[model samples]
Target: MEKKSIQNTLLMGFIEDIKLRYKTGNIVEKFIFINIGVFIASLLFKVIFGLYKTNGDFIFNWFALEHNFSTLITKPWSIISYGFLHAGFIHILFNMIALYYIGNLFIQYFTQKQLVQFYVLGTFFGGLLFMLSNSYFPLFEGTRPHLVGASAGISAIFIGLTTYMPNYQLQIRFIGFVKLWHLAAIWIGLDVIGLVGSNAGGHFSHLGGALFGFLYVNQAANTKLNIWDKLSGIFTSRKKPLHTVYKSSKKTAPKSKNTDLTQQQIDGILDKISKSGYDSLTKSEKEFLFKQGKK
Candidate 1:
């Protein structure tokens, strides 16, 4: 009975550790969860309302500006909120997948705060472009369309990360290794090509998001806070000192003992290295493993 109890306790502990790791894994995971949650909610709503259209009409009809052009003048928030609501499962899935790859690369170097800023700003600009294109373009003059999906935000992250690390490379299944900039070029090229065909609104929004992403990286490198940072500061208190140090009379103790990675964490890292190459390890992992090797 005692042995069984010990085994059960160990299993429970392992499960709890996994839960924590997943919860705090990385920015990519968080973005995926948010997108999935929103997709599910939209799906439920659509089912309840019996709205099953897919030609981007439903998005414009309900959440976006329909024939009632007067309503848009009063409710401008629709432009932003519309992006979160998707047309179907496949739509959300593809955008979320793109977001995961792009966002992971972004948060690898940037702080979570910066990641959120880029995403929101990109989405705003993307929506703005969509609105402007619809309003001004002679072809789309009569049609007021609605834009949806995380594509704009995802595109921004992609562009931002590629700009920051232009030479970064990834291994493709068919192509062994390819530079990040080339990949970004291909992505943008597709959007440009798509512009000449159907889904012009989505393509135009992609351009807007891409522009914001490019400008953001350049501005950030020069030490200028982008609009998102300034906007966030409005709600947060500014009186607090930017940096603080805590002091105690007792000798400051080394944190190494308490900070050592657990056996499970070490195993997980090793497993990842086995599946992917050692290069797959992020900077933090490489440092941790290097320290462990020395010890």
Candidate 2:
């Protein structure tokens, strides 16, 4: 009975820790957790069904996007689901690394909500554009291609950052600092070339995302393109999670100016962690978070 009781206590503590992490984590961490969680679950399912020896394509089909019009009709969720699906470890690693750097740099100028909106929209449009092209193009007339991975979303983020700050220089390995627009050009060019070799749908989706990223940043600057705010407002009226985010700050005790933690500051740190990971935290920042936990 004591051992069982101890097990229960430990499990409860672990669950609370997980909840706290998710509650405090910024948009990037949440997305990574969801994607990695889904990937792990997919592998577990395959192993359980003894399909590990096979290609395991069937295991991921339920979530992977289908280029075929008829097959996609019943699995519409794949539009977004496919972004979270990855065929191999290397695929996910590169995509996540790109998202981390791009998203972090993006949040330096834009809000976290804007970053998420770009990612979501980029992935959706990428898939949509691919489907539209495939439906009309003669080159892919007889093939049914499956779209998967976060590359489109990552591509959108990468291009969006480049579009927003075209002259920003990045220090490339074995090369001196170069302008973002130059990098964007090279990346898109490679994808265009890859389309002719193989994985045409993936490459097409990437171009779609890149195009959207370029247009979205340019268009918003010219007008009141507050799409993320409008979508958030829709959820704000619901009897759900939105209300919790803005709950009374009165609950927390007041502090001196030296220790004061504003919402914006907290959000910035969270965003940094999301883009750069926990180890990026300084000693003082870690101490502040520890203090918050105690509270």
Candidate 3:
């Protein structure tokens, strides 16, 4: 009875620890936890099916993105759902690793909501391209393949970050420091070369996600053409301005002087980070950027 009680206590403690981590973790950590949880659940289902000598893959059948347009119409949720599913341990392992690193870096610059948008939209675009390629391309003719994995969403985040900070340097253990865009180019090149391979559909989906990431970053880089602002304007109520009242120069002078940081200063700091990496910033610059990120 004592041994059983101890085991129960340990299990409860472990579960509570996980809950605590999930609650306080950043967006990247939360995503990694979710992918791991989903993967474990999928493995459990597979084992149960195997135990019963059942050949049916109920989970993948319903959640994985189908190649056929008709099947997709019936199971629209699969478009985004497929990104959360994985075919094997090795598949999810590498994907989650990539997502963890890239996503953490992404979150340092962008908001959590923007990361979610990139992931979901990237997955949607990837699934769409997968189905379209299967439908129109001669290469995919007479073959039906379902897509699964978080690679598409990860690719979106990866490519999007690369587009924003192309010169950013990432130190690889054995490879030294490599430019972000260099890695992104190689990533896309590999997918392009994989089009004729067995996992052609997967490659197509990756490219689709990368394309969205690239386009999104490019569009967002232009502040005047921000899509988010335009979309928000549609839902936001506007009212005509009242007559402007001039403030005394004497009162405004001290207020302007009190503002230590300006938009131009922030822009210059961002440009420095882009060219020389975040570590290039001095203590004060880093602190400023960190404080700005919090706001």
Question: What's the true lDDT of residue 157 in model 3?
Answer: 89
Per-residue lDDT for 140-203 in model 3, tens only? 8788799999989999889988977899888999999999999999999999999999999999
- Cα lDDT tens digits, model 2, 214-267, are 666644422233556543342232222111111223344666574455545665
What Cα-based lDDT does every candidate model obtain? Answer: 0.67, 0.73, 0.81
Model 1, 206: alpha-carbon shift in Å?
A: 0.7
What does the lDDT read for residue 293 in candidate 1? Answer: 47
Off by over 4 Å in 2: 1-19, 51-59, 221-225, 228-295
Which residue pairs show collisions in model 1?
Answer: none
Top candidate when judged by TM-score against the true structure: 3
lDDT by residue (tens digit), candidate 1, 1-295: 9999999999999979866866987767776776676677655655656654534243335554222335656766765666676767788889877877777666555566677777777877887887777766776756655677778888888887777657667889988878778999998999989876668888888888898887656444223334544543533433321110111122245546444444446657765653454578999988776665454
Q: Which candidate leads in lDDT?
A: 3
The per-prediction tally of clashing pairs is 0, 0, 0
Candidate 3 yields a Cα-based lDDT of 0.81
TM-score of 3: 0.84
lDDT of 1: 0.67
Q: Candidate 3: where is the Cα deviation over 4 Å?
A: 221-264, 288-295
